[model samples]
Target chain A: MKRRTFLKLATATTMSTLAAPYVHAQEKKFAGITLRFGGWGGLYDETIQKYVAAPLEERTGLKVQITAGTQSADLVKLVANKENPPFDVYQADSAYMVEALKADLIQEVTEAEVPNIKRILPGFREYGEYGVPYSVFTYIPIYNSELVEQPLTTYTDLTRPDLEGRVALPAATFDTWSLYLLALAEENGGSISNMEPAYSLLEQAKSNILALAQSTVAMIQMFETKEASAGVISDARGHELRTKGHPIVSVYPPQGIYGATSYMNVVKNAKHPEAAFAFLDQMLSDEGMLGLPRALRLGVTTDVKLPDEIAKDLTFNTPERIALKKKVDWQKWMADRSARIERINKILRG
Target chain B: MRYDFTDYVLIVAGAVTRVAVYALLALPAALVVVLSFTSGETMDFPPAGFSMQWYQKAFESEPFMSALWTSTYVAVIVAIAALVIGFAAAFAINRFDFPGKGLLQALAFSPLIVPAVVLGIGLLYLFAWMNLIQTMFPLFAGHLVLAIPYVVRTVLASLTLHNRVLEEAAMNLRASPLRVVRRITLPLILPGLLSAAIFAFVTSFGNVTVSVFLTYGGNVTLPVQLFTYLDHSYNPLVAAVSSIMIFVTLAVILTIERLIGAETLS
Candidate 1:
């Protein structure tokens, strides 16, 4: 090459390298745009703001307005204002997603809009093309390590003589009772279509039930106080009790664990679609995916590497682990919810 | 010196009942406050260690502080509005006969009988269809509906107990009705008003159901915030937030006591 040509190329390259930051600033075209997000509060919201929203704001000059609200109420807000959504993105759990879809309250986006959609575990994308799971919770059997002599392998084991009058389970009134019912059903050769087997199994287990706790807090307290020798609870909650110096042990049942998930979806009539999609891409990114796992021991949906200690305390931490995690058929469950709740109430409350 | 056996038994039972009532009323709250200082992750009873980290987090948290502020201002506004409207309605009902007086009385106390769930959804759908939920009016109105009944009841009771002769004397001396009300009636009902304000304040502040349906993103009251938090999961921070809430209530009571004598509050 001629010296003149080499000099020209070097000078131009240096100038462009110097102007790269300026070019990046220009690419931040969404500077004035604000994306509204409806999400969980407490540690969950705090973690999202810290890990996903803040960095995205700095990188793209777009602001995220995160509004904390009850999940069901939030869906009501969207349904009430279906023509003009108040939020651009929202965190929708299973029941909310079903109802939102029925009401046509959310938009569907493909991998073209959000590249990270490809990274979301296929099982966690059970909400179809509308949303992807950001974090997952597991329903696992637990027992008082110091009180119970035998290890529990299945929900059927709660009927064992050792667990009689020392077992506690969630009442039908509890929001997440379907998962527990499904576990019992799956273990007894029935599924969501026929939860009848689980009820009869529950009848045998009834003699053992010290109480059907009305809430998760009640369930935890029963375990904490050793009032319950063996039962089922959220994996994170069990691990939390263990972390807090309780004698609780999480048991892996033979059929595996039940999956309860929280998802991030774009609102149907979002004012800022590109910005909302960008925010979603970051949520599925490695940094954002690990926030819940780090904060609350929730399993990450994407294949983000977690510290071994954190992974050990969580469920669905890998594709293999997720493969074992069964997502509930929320539609069928929701449809039969009233009848099931009534029957379970009679069985458990009795 | 010479007490009857029946008298002694009655006295012993009375003493026992008083202690039992105090233990039932106060011990649970005291234990919760004690658990709030827990250094451990869970807010279990009889905490293992002590730490102010939760309180520190509560004060530092933007969402918590914002929600606290929202609850405070919302309660303050609702209480003030309920106080004015309640005092007027109670005075009018107490002072004069009107058409549909019985119906008006029933209407004032109607909210107490109607379930809060019904009211919440009623108000939510009422203003929600108009898209007025973007403003704070829906929450304010809902709280007002829930709070007005308490105020009206308290003020009506106060007005009934008020001496009518003083107002008559003031009027006979050529004092205007407004002046008589300002001078004689209000001073007499001061205690009732004070107590009623506290009722309204606490009612709006601690409300969850109606507020839950009405609250938007930034306007959530403290109770709804805590409710949603617990709905998702429970953490020690809840205890801390609750402790702060108790402290705020106590502080408000103390401030009122200082401003108006405790006897008046009682």
Candidate 2:
């Protein structure tokens, strides 16, 4: 072979090697696809944009358009647009997931489509194949340590004389209130089906209750204002308060803490199914799971190891801690929630 | 010079009542504005320290800013639409009599009598059936329905207070019907039109119950955004947003007052 021919071939090989990565990078898997994600706004949406959407877009070339709203609002929109759903993927709490499933508004997800589903811890995968658990939070007793003399070790402490007119309980409409009722019932001898014991306990503690907070934010305000000395609150919120120098401490009662999981589901008639799956897959990834604890201080379902600082505050990430989480039959609880809530209202008002 | 015990007592009672009403209305807004300046992370009365950090956050937030823009855009459209339709309807009711005139007048003000939540749900269902729930059109339409009644009521009140003799005299002087409306009738009712437009704008801007059902796909209004924010986080950011709203609303009221005098509203 001639020297000129060899030199020309060498230059061509070098040029192709440099250009290959650029060419591959330009060929995006979801370049043209835009996935519509419906979920809670405020911090949740901000965290999702920072952690999930931005990263997913960079990885797969998928563009995300977020529609922020309450879970019920999103569900209403989904139901309203059932024929041509506006959102490709919707994130909702477990209770609302049940509603979505019953209404046939969401599609079942598969491991093949979302490979990161395998990363979630056992039992965290909820709604069968219809939904995947993204974040988990445990509701436990939280109190301002400076205000309460005695350290609360169990849910029964809420009924103590010292807590009278100082305890802040979640309103009957809040998800945490139902979990608190279940925990109270289980601690006493009643099961999930029979909330009589819970109602009785609440009736006894009625005089102690300062207020029934309408929301988690309201619950936090109760603590901030010193209106509440002790109350039932989420572990994540408790951690957040403590972090903000609020003197609050979260206690996982010996009776066990109740867990609430937020699930992500694909709409039944999603316009961009593949892009939706890509987004869900990112949520289950190690990067995705870790973002929850980092951004929102919430627990993740995936087995991704958390940083020591974040892990210390989480209650359901470890095996021993997971064992202490009490699982309520949410489907059963939701089915009879209206009557239970009415009974609770009567008990609290009694 | 010779006021009796009952007269003095009644004067004192009226003064006390006026003061009480003013305090009741102004105190909460004043409190919210004060709380907006808190340096602390959470909202608390007599806030820990004074800072404009929350206002900074409010300005920096994309969701709040986007909702603010959406609200302003929609309100302007609603105000214009309500003004045009309401003025037409009010003019017809005042100047002409037709069959079912009573029914038409009743329908014009029916939204005010109907419960907002019921109307919201009804609109939601209707929009859903029409496959129009996903778009911002429903929100605009819902707010227009809510705001039209105020427009009609105010315009009708203005028409009643102002004599039609000027309009009749103008028409009798060889002025065309449109010319009378443009020159005489419109000028006399200009203040009422301004009042109605402001009322409609504020009504559309601050609405939540109806807008809540119609909002979708990143088209949330500011009030709904604030409401949803309360579900997860409690911070001075909400207070700051609210303060901005109050200030903007005050500015609008002041502008209207400057432009058309406050007594025009009466």
Most accurate candidate by lDDT: 2
Q: Itemize residue pairs with steric clashes in candidate 1.
A: A165-A208
Per-residue lDDT of candidate 2, residues B1-266 (tens digit): 99999999999999999999999999999999999999887666789899999999999999999998998899989999999999999999987989988998999999999999789878887888998887999999999999999999999989888999998898889999999999998899999998899899999999988887788778889988888777667678989999988887778779889877888645
Poorly placed runs, candidate 2 (over 4 Å): A1-27, B263-266
- The runs of at least 3 residues in candidate 1 whose Cα sits more than 4 Å from the true structure, single-residue gaps closed, are A1-27, B1-4
Each candidate's DockQ score against the native complex?
0.50, 0.61
Clashes of each: 1, 1
Per-model TM-score, in order, reads 0.93, 0.94
Task: Give every collision pair in model 2.
Answer: A165-A208
What are the per-residue Cα lDDT tens digits for candidate 1 across B1-266?
88999999999999999999999998877887898899988776679699999899889978888999999998899999999999998988898998988898899999999999788878877887887876789999999999999999999999998789999999999999899989999998888997888889999999988887788656678887787677556777888899888888788778888988998768
User: Model 2: number of clashes?
Assistant: 1
